[model samples]
Target chain A: MSLTPSKRAYVPFVSVEHMMGLVHHIGIEQVLTDLASEIEADFRRWPLFDKTPRVASHSDVGVIELMPTSDGETYGFKYVNGHPKNTAEGLQTVTAFGLLAEVDSGYPTLLSEMTLLTALRTAATSAMAAKHLAPKGARTMAMIGNGAQSEFQCLAFKAVCGIDTVRLYDIDTSATTRCAGNLAANGLTVVECRSGQEAMEGAQIITTCTADKQYATILTDNMVGSGVHINAIGGDCPGKTELHRDILLRSSIFVEYPPQTRVEGEIQQLEHDHAVTELWKVIEGQVSGRTDDRQITLFDSVGFAIEDFSALRYIAKAVKGTPFFTELDMIADPDDPRDLFGMFQRAKS
Target chain B: MSLTPSKRAYVPFVSVEHMMGLVHHIGIEQVLTDLASEIEADFRRWPLFDKTPRVASHSDVGVIELMPTSDGETYGFKYVNGHPKNTAEGLQTVTAFGLLAEVDSGYPTLLSEMTLLTALRTAATSAMAAKHLAPKGARTMAMIGNGAQSEFQCLAFKAVCGIDTVRLYDIDTSATTRCAGNLAANGLTVVECRSGQEAMEGAQIITTCTADKQYATILTDNMVGSGVHINAIGGDCPGKTELHRDILLRSSIFVEYPPQTRVEGEIQQLEHDHAVTELWKVIEGQVSGRTDDRQITLFDSVGFAIEDFSALRYIAKAVKGTPFFTELDMIADPDDPRDLFGMFQRAKS
Candidate 1:
């Protein structure tokens, strides 16, 4: 029996640098547009997925998690961490990576840095939610918390929802300046607002992407206008939230997966019996979405594995034609399936 | 505060070869014996564990799976693949690896090759069951499948249960010869038998670990003698059974994690309500063990993530003094935790 590494043994891994380059090349808006479609397509066939909330390993300072999903054929999982203190030491508060593999031979097909992709996908998911949940003709957006993810959120709304005006606010005026500065090249009108209230004025879509790991409220009920869509992003973990309880109570909430969103999203403040709709059901046409033009709609945007799965698929396609992929020796090739011991014995320590 | 790479970084990873070397250095028998205790210690606190069956991605030729579990403080997961046809092309039917992380920080503290460790843990778990379930004075073991895992299973029984005689049988005589040859230095009386019945004669334990992806009976109803303990390892997946239905009906079956074993273990053929005791209950002294010498005890050993967790712990300890460890760039350290984009902007693509 002849045993050799298959000609198809290479698994392309996208590093943080490589992924960033790809994102830079495609431009953030294009990436978000493509990712939105990918996420929508995957969510349509939700029954084929073996879905579960990520298995998280939380540390005192932060959290590390593995989010896995399978579509009966291909399996995908992401390794991500969120450490608010990491920023104090010059490390990003959130870093991530992911793997995709074949179910049959257990061969890894792709390994990619998900840090950048997470930012992109989060923005895409927010835009997707706003598309279905936002009021019709929503052209103005308020982006509170102008940090690493704020730029992507602005561009996604601009590219996907035809929002021409983006109002930015942050405790750090420099962050707002930087966010507005980036959008300078994107041909969108940018307003560097002084407070959340200023940014929310006349804005149809409001996004909160703050990085603080606390229960601090960036949005109050008085700041919200009628018929506004709220994209709550930063209130992901147990102690973190963006909108005040009063704001959430006033809005009709939608979530990625309710069981998970109940703990990590803004809905953590709500009672278990409180009603909410899963975004997929809305996309699947199983539930009504944003029935009235003046109704408040909230997309409690705690990220999900399916979105990462979608992002991985998007990047895999995006990197296919570029030199932005690296390969890793992630799996084994044994000459004789019975000779597992022999394979181990032959490998170098 | 100066945070250097050395202060925060662990060693590089221990690859498949390094793990095999550690096993050979410590001797497989000793590793399995130690693993038996580790598993017992964890199993005693089984209620604290959050258990779930692995999330599998199935393909036409094989399957890849991610198995995850947590005990509130620590979280662990294993990535594994099973490709029956891989052996024909020189790949082992199974290849695996896993990680252990602290629950608080979500940092992966340990990453090790589980390919070799899986074999060791499977053997350890079987011996653990045999320690309490096998008939007293069970010395002679009949090994029906003399493949790569055969030696480990035999030696584990030897080290854990004082089995001094191993009666070997396989459809391929060379496999039996190889098993005997590998165990020559272990000082056991190795008997080569032509058939399963011949191998079972006077043997107190029968271990069936054949790799055929079919319902191939390595043990028939007539072959299992009274008071014999059976370790059924190969019948781990659906439609994969090594024992006749009547044999399982006659034996007092004990299992690891019932939800999993019901789908993958030897008792998958049995009726849904077939009585089986969880091995942990027996370990905790909550349940009675082998009541009489005439009773047949069967360990429906569908391997669980906890055993892998324990095995990863065992190997980590064994390699503590050795240079067989390596760390991967699995996690990220962003300079300025809030500025995740800067990492990408500055990183060399």
Candidate 2:
């Protein structure tokens, strides 16, 4: 027997392989550039969104979180887990998936593997922030703590901010080597460095994305120059930070959302009432980004739900005419909604 | 190019059809009985589980909720939506899907359609509660508001509490006809009634499972007898209830997870600190169920996440050696955990 799923029964699902295929088909650099544009568009209309801090459940090993947001028309949420020790057991430290649904019906429209999309969106957001805060003609980036996200960050900078060189460093030299090898055939020149200080030498932009779960100083106040933009991604959860406190004291800090950043970003080390600039204000031209070339600036990003929402929307639109998604029969739609029992009885026959 | 998903990438997915097939294969009544046993076992070990009020996002039309819970070893969550007006437009008023994950790694193990499973578990849970709370030798159940959930409630009572007769009533006569027609082949004798009062005549157990989203009462205080057990299922959200407050005043109310039931269950109409017994305590033998034939008992159930967790675990275990599930390549697993960039790059070839 064969069954034809009704329109409501099928939801478009982009698996990991199909997500990779879509990324490659769209050209990774082009996709990153497009994502940055999409994110910027949403950020410009930030006040229209319904935002909330992620709902998290933490255990001794790691934390699982659900981040949800809506723009009145569509709803989206990402289910992600962070387990730093998972890599030691041959597992990814983070895995994620997301769904987009219609606000009118509350039915899921698309379900996609978001591990790859997250990497892309995080990079795009960092580059988008740097585009407004970085020094003019910034061409080189110092990528500290080379890990799974390093290459995507490097390429996003090259695509969005015109960065042509990336100097990489990690405590584990093998990670730096892996990152360099992955970027070998990509357009940018990759520089390997023995220390964070060496990697920071003569770079106009600095990115730190280490995976340690505790407070660790990847950059001291002395290592950071005054004229560069800093992208901080690793110090995301409570008690986790990358840059030394002294550096934050000197830089003009900007954050995605203050309530969430106060708990999960580098600002957690500071007082609750400490003044910080909202990133959307700069994007909206309500505040100045970099008044002088010698002034330091930092983007304290703890990934937000809006970015994931934008990425899901981007993928849902990108895969429309492409064969990169499969329709999964996920919803139970009966011919007569009140006859759900009859639907099951007929299915038995 | 062909891609073979590794074990880490594959998450077991049970679609709606597959879930129906699994239910039929296991026999509907037997599945209900097994689900009740599983739920009871979990209730016995209740203190070992982490519980929280469901995270809900409400809109003008409906509400979408994420209900999450975790034992020390496994984590589970259900994504469910409720839109009362959906049935008028030929859509199920409630649709759901759920995920179960490994707590240590925070990776999803199973993804299953929970619409059918939810009906099964909700009925199973109701019957489980009735088994302890209902009067001895209670063989008749008056089912008010015969809609999607009516048949399941009837069958579950038959299998779990030895209920042999069901008297059905609905505001829509067609709904009552549909429900009674569906139950015609089942082992129980079905009686059609024109009004709720007619259905309640000579019934030992009264079940109200209406779907209206208002403060309307289907049963009045004078309509209920002193010795009957009332299974109230439809007053599951704020401003939606089936029983008048006077009936609640005379009964010993049992609830699941007081923190949640206080807001969404029938008890929302009561005071903040209104005394109610936790159903787990009754199952643990700490509290009395039906102390005497003259005492009134009420199972005021607003579904909890632990029940969904148990249902997911049961499905994950039941379809072990069966063809009732499909593997979904949902997680992106790099060969080397830190080389996620390399994995994406290699997938391009």
The number of clashing residue pairs in each candidate reads: 29, 0
In terms of docking quality, model 2 is high
Query: What C-alpha lDDT do the candidate models reach, one value each?
Result: 0.80, 0.93
- DockQ of each candidate, alpha-carbon based: 0.35, 0.85
Q: Model 2 misses residue B163 by how many Å?
A: 0.6
lDDT of 1 by residue, A196-283 (tens): 8889888999999887778988887787877889899999998888888998888888988877899898988889878998888889
Chain A TM per prediction = 0.95, 0.99
The candidate 2 chain A region of ten consecutive residues with least summed lDDT is A1-10
- Model 2 ranges with Cα > 4 A deviation: A1-3, B1-3
* Docking class of predicted structure 1: acceptable
Compared with the real two-chain complex, what DockQ does model 1 have? 0.35
Query: Positional deviation of B287 in candidate 1, in angstroms?
Result: 5.3
> TM-score of model 2 relative to the true fold?
0.98
Native-to-model Cα distance after best TM-score fit, residue A31 in candidate 1, in Å = 3.3
